[model samples]
Target chain A: MFVRGLKSSIIALESNLKNRTLFFLLNFVLLVTVFIEILTYKHSIALEPHRYQNFTDDILIVQMHYDSETPYTFSSIFDRKLASIENVLYTQYAINQYIYNKETYQLSVKIKGTSGNFIENYDIVDFYYKTNGLPNVKKNELIYGRVWTNEEYQKGESVGLIYEATAKTIFGKSDATGERLNFGSHSIKIIGILKNTDDIKNYYRTFNNYNLEFVVYTPITYLKSDSLIDYSIMRSYNNDILKEIITNNISEKMYFYEREDVISKTLDIKKEQLSNFYYVIVVTLIICVVGLFQLIKNFINQMTFECSIRRTFGATKFEIFSMLVFQNSFVFLLALMLAIVVSIMIIYAYFYFSYRYVYPYLSYIDINIILIIGIAQLILTIAFTTLLSQKIINTNIIDGVKGNS
Target chain B: MYELINVSKSYGKNQIFTNLNFTIESKKFTGIFGESGSGKTTLVSILGMLDQKYTGNYIFNGINITQLGDRELSTLRKEKIGFLFQESYLINEITVFDNLLLNVLDKENKQLIKRIRELMDKFAISDFLYRRVSTLSGGEKQRVALVRALLMNPELIIADEPTGNLDKTNSEIILSYLKSLCLENKTVIVVSHDEKVLKYCDIQYNLIKNGKLERCL
Candidate 1:
């Protein structure tokens, strides 16, 4: 009798594939939401072990525009002294003229010129650099494309330039080397294209503000500027020296930030964005639960007569209960498998489009989701259906079988 | 054999049967006759162990059924009692053979299949044994129900209007098959509104809406 009940149950489920599909899809949506959220948490865990360290020897120092009332040349007065400070870094930006082909957009080129220490201090080596050498910058040299090339770094010349991700929108599939770019009416030949680094997100997509964008890399000494006074940092061997230097040189307008602080700030911003998304995910899950409850209720109601018939044939309350649960579980398992396949396809597509996040080829589904969904559905179906069918077991059998309910 | 001792049943404030006493002797085909709302169906239910919320003592063979626990009562119903209804309540989606074979869960009981085949052939319903219940005719479905009931080799059969949906000829045929159960000394009780069925019954009882039972001619 139990076997027959199962066979009939399977027939019923197969006959109503549409309804089962809807149920399966709702569970899938919840599974996907939980999967993504758990992945987010996992991302934090992977990142925590490799936390950024702020060594007192390094700092971010910004230099004010050179012409404001300070008449002394910062180069002659500070060059020798600052160079001895250990790990001094400077950057400069130039407005470049270019056209974006994909979105038919245009922007000025934003450039960063830094010494060899730039890549070391940022810890971009393990993530982006494939070689041990720093980006060797020399006068009038450029390294093109998205990343630093060994040939450009090895020559100790500033001629090769790396193209920012946004450069692709302006010159889709075009060999961009040797092209003369006009920046503030000053033309410089594009040398090399930089490959995408993991640090910058979506380095290939085009942006509107070309000047404000990270579009290219060039040799630090090649930049020509009179107002581009030196933005250099001095590292101290101890906190006392660091504090003493900052205390004496402190200005009310200057802003100082540490590397650890910068990383925390970025993470905090990401957390805020995810919190808003959490609300939507939670609401969707609640709706799905309600829908699942209603569906199970309606289905059990329709089977009241069958339950009565089974009871007449000597089915114990537990046996009857088992049959219902077995039916529901079989259907749930089928739908669960289908939904997993669907969700994996979607996750794969997402990773294909956004590979900058180091997304693994596949992620393990959190056990909490499986437990909550699998156990909850099983318990709810059994409880609701059994409660509904209890009347069949206890009711006057004559009316139950006579289609009176 | 089944005995009802002063059994009384009610629905809310409405009393359907009160202090009713009756007995269905072993191997006797007893028919219960009444008008609509005459409480015949309710009486059949109590006999089938389907109705428990009643004030009375029901003794099957020698055990008082009302005192049994849900599990014990269910065991009694499954292993001893059988039922036939006016409309065949077979799960329409399954094949008729599967519907009949489903009742015997003890797979090694080869007698189940042999009994089912004999019953189906006896009722001339063997042709549609593999067909879906929904596709069977009214007469054929009733025969299938008979096969299902007889498969368990139950001690007693409680049928409520077993042939009520059949024409006069089919009704006689069904009643005759039911009468054979009595010949085998299997206690049988049926609730019916059809007057024609009274002839086949060895004993008949009439239930009054005023809550009384009387032996009928």
Candidate 2:
């Protein structure tokens, strides 16, 4: 009886493939919204860690036009105002350039030229761990060597970290921590080794076409100048007065945003997108629910004669209702599977084409959101189906045989 | 033997039966003739045990149907009776063999296959074994439905308007096959208004005016 009834249900599904396809496509749209929101979040965070707990709301990031005339860049006014902003916990500089050097190093690093200013070009980030943490990792990554000592950060040391693969190719071993590499006039010592994971390689894809994360960690003082400073970050103490001072000083050449300003701006856009998605989800959910109800109504009405026929052949009400439940539940399951497969394919395709690698983006996914949506969808299906099975069981066999609803 | 004693049924305010009584003997042909909207369908349902919403003592094989629950009633119906409706009642999208597979006690029983094949051969429907029910002509479909009705090897076959959709030649063929079943010690009860069908019944009843069951003189 189970096999026979299941077969009939499958035939019913196959006969109504158009309705089932519509159902699957509606659910697919809902899942796409969630996945696209997740991808957007990944982009907003510079695509490294899932959580950015260390970047508190009070920290201010100042950006200025590099190579601007005198007193217009952070390397001038901002550097001179450092002492006045008292009780600030930490201050850092971001000065990066791409120098296509053909020396023994093949390095993309730029440092103090003969004029004590950075040479401008494209390269990886050179940052010293201001919190005395390992600069090799962003959040949850593990690296090979050690973090910088307090003395190294305070004394403006010229030591740096290199990727393990880069160290292997240039210095003959992966553990060449003490080895010195001459860049133009400097012989910076390698102090640590980045783990050289695929995530780091994806990070390199954002900058140059090189597949290596040739990052070097050094003190901010090593690359600073009174000329060009890419950007500067500092912990807040008296930032309001400092902002007033800086705005009054360099408002034409620079802009400053606190962590709250940046995060709120990203969140505002996300909220708008998500609210629109909520409407789509709600509308499609209404369509899906109404569609299933109407489908079941028609199914029961059309199958009334057949149900009576089966009943006359000694089929129980239980058997008939079981067949109905099996058919509806099967369609719901098929739709859910369709959504999962399509969403995964879309994410993979986007990453593969855009970044040439999908490894870094994988680390930024919040799977709980996806699972919650999936489970919620399943619950809706189950609830709607079971609620309607009563109508199926209660259909009058006498009326049914006579072709009555 | 089957007997209905002091049976009464009603729908809200309108009543279908009030203390109606009847008896049908085993291994004999009984016929019921009624027009549309008459109480013949109600009586058929009561005797078929497809309905139980009535006050009656319906004794079938010496067991009262009123004392049975749905499960026991379903079991009794499935194991003891076979029903042949007017429309053939077979899934048109499936093959004749698959439709027959729905009626047996155990679908996997090997002897059941032999039994089905034997019955199909007896009815001259062996050629329709793999054909979808929808593709067959009306007469062919009715023959296949007859073969399905006999799969459970039940003692009684209740055929409700078994030839309503058939031409005269095909109707005669179905009625002849049903009448022949009584010689095999099978009790056949057929309900129809067609004079050609009710003529074959040994004991015939008429309900043409939608009233109490009255024996046709």
Candidate 3:
């Protein structure tokens, strides 16, 4: 009996191909819109942790600038006070130089002097260094940043690495670890090679808008005669007190910048984007529901005579209502299945060509969310269709049979 | 048997029937003939339990139909009364066989299938069994409608202008079929304006002036 009813419904659906096609197209658009919204929401949620990974609530960046009147040992004065603070974690200082010239090699490049814990604190990855095949660095030793790896180089008095772009610019290859270069009076031997110059460029672009390619890192002890720190990066349990302390103790010529402020601003922008997507989803859902209601209503009107005939043929009111519901539910289920397939294909294609780091974040497309949305859509459709069918069943059978009402 | 006592039906200010009393017995072909606005259709609608708004004591066999709820009325309609409309109200999208078996809950019952086949052969619609009803002529559609009406073997078959759309020859064929149903101890009530169709009824009533039914034959 169920099969018979199903067969009759299929016939009815086939006979009204134009209406069914319109319904399918409308529902497909709705499902795809919903799927895209869900995908973006999931992507944003996945990237939330990574974006704020370095910007812990308690961490702060304090940039200090000095002039001729300022003391050369300005950073050392804060070191004692910062360590004495109750919630202070640790502080690392850095000095930047853009006028490093190697006369023999004719290479002028930017360099940075960093403290020992710089790599661990900054969350840098793919760091490699070797002094004559011994992968370690000591005080005053140089570490060359290479974009890629190549042949091994012999150890020298000072070990260094060059960025891949720097190697490509001078040696015509990405791997120039075996080469030696001079920085003023110092001859630096290339030791280690870093893998991704693009990552370094992105990091520098995000923080200070400085060009990061071809930059070199050396120990802060290397700047013995010029002991002026450019920036200080630190982590603490109480940023509020630290901010206040820095504001009070800093000289008139020095300025302080906090990392937490930058993260908060970026998160505000992302939150705005998420809210905008939600608005679009809600509006689209409204349009979908209204359009679906009209479509189902029109279908019921067209099937009035059929319903009346069924009622006359001993079909109870519920049976008449169920037939219409079953027919529409079948169509909706088919449309939903097609929409799911299309949505998955679109999402996979987008992520496949995007950045590698983005791939990990795509894993947050929650299956439970999809199921909830699908079930909600199903329930919503059924509710409206059932209401419409009830109205249809309540219509006078004689009027329906005559197609007058 | 069905009886209506002091039955009155009205639509707002327009009255269709007032203080009408009528009785229809089993095992007979009864026809109710009237003019265009004489409420012939309304009378049969009430008899078939399709309209429950009329104030009356409507008894089907021994049960008070007016006292029955909508569900009970629906069950009574399903089990005891068959309805046929002038439009031959068939679902045009399905085949003739499906239309005939529309009311049968069990489509795979061999006994029902055999009965449907015999009726199809009797009506000479066996060749159009798989044909879409929309593609059939008016006469063929009415025959299919008749088969569907009789599919459940209801005790009372109420047809409103069942031959109103048919030509003379097709009209006689349908009238003869209604008459044959009387031989099986089933009551067939037909409402029509056609004099030729009226001549075939065993007993006939004319709904005349002031919403009254007068026995004509």
Candidate DockQ values, in order, are 0.32, 0.41, 0.31
Poorest 10 consecutive residues by lDDT, candidate 2 chain A: A92-101
Off by over 4 Å in 3: A1-25, A41-274, A350-360, B105-108
Predicted candidate 2 versus true structure: per-residue lDDT over A232-267, tens digit per residue: 322233456445444554333333211123344555
For each candidate, what is the lDDT? 0.57, 0.61, 0.63
Candidate 3 lDDT over residue span B1-217, tens digit each: 7889999998799899898989998889999999988888778778887777889799899899888776687777877888877878876766887776666533547777887888889999989889888899999999988888887779999989988899989988988988898999999999988888767888899998568999988
lDDT tens string, model 1, B91-170?
Answer: 77767877775454334246766888888899988888888887988888888998888878898988888888999888
RMSD vs true structure, all candidates: 13.1, 12.0, 12.5
| Cα error of candidate 3 at position A10, Å | 5.6
Worst 10 residues of 1 chain A by lDDT: A91-100
In candidate 1, residue A170 scores what lDDT?
A: 34
Give lDDT for model 1.
0.57
TM-score of chain B of each: 0.94, 0.94, 0.94
Q: Give the clashing pairs for model 3.
A: A143-A161, A144-A160, A144-A161, A145-A161, A145-A162, A146-A194, A147-A164
**Candidate 3 lDDT over residue span A1-405, tens digit each:** 678666666665665566677777877778777876777566665555443221122111111111112212223223312232222212212111111122121111212222211211121111123333322323122234431122222111344554555555444466677766443234445555544335655553443333333444332122333322223323332445444444454322133222223445666888888888877777877877787788778877877877776676667787777777777787878888888878877876776675444555455446466567767878877888888888778877777778767
Calculate model 1's interface RMSD in Å.
Answer: 4.2
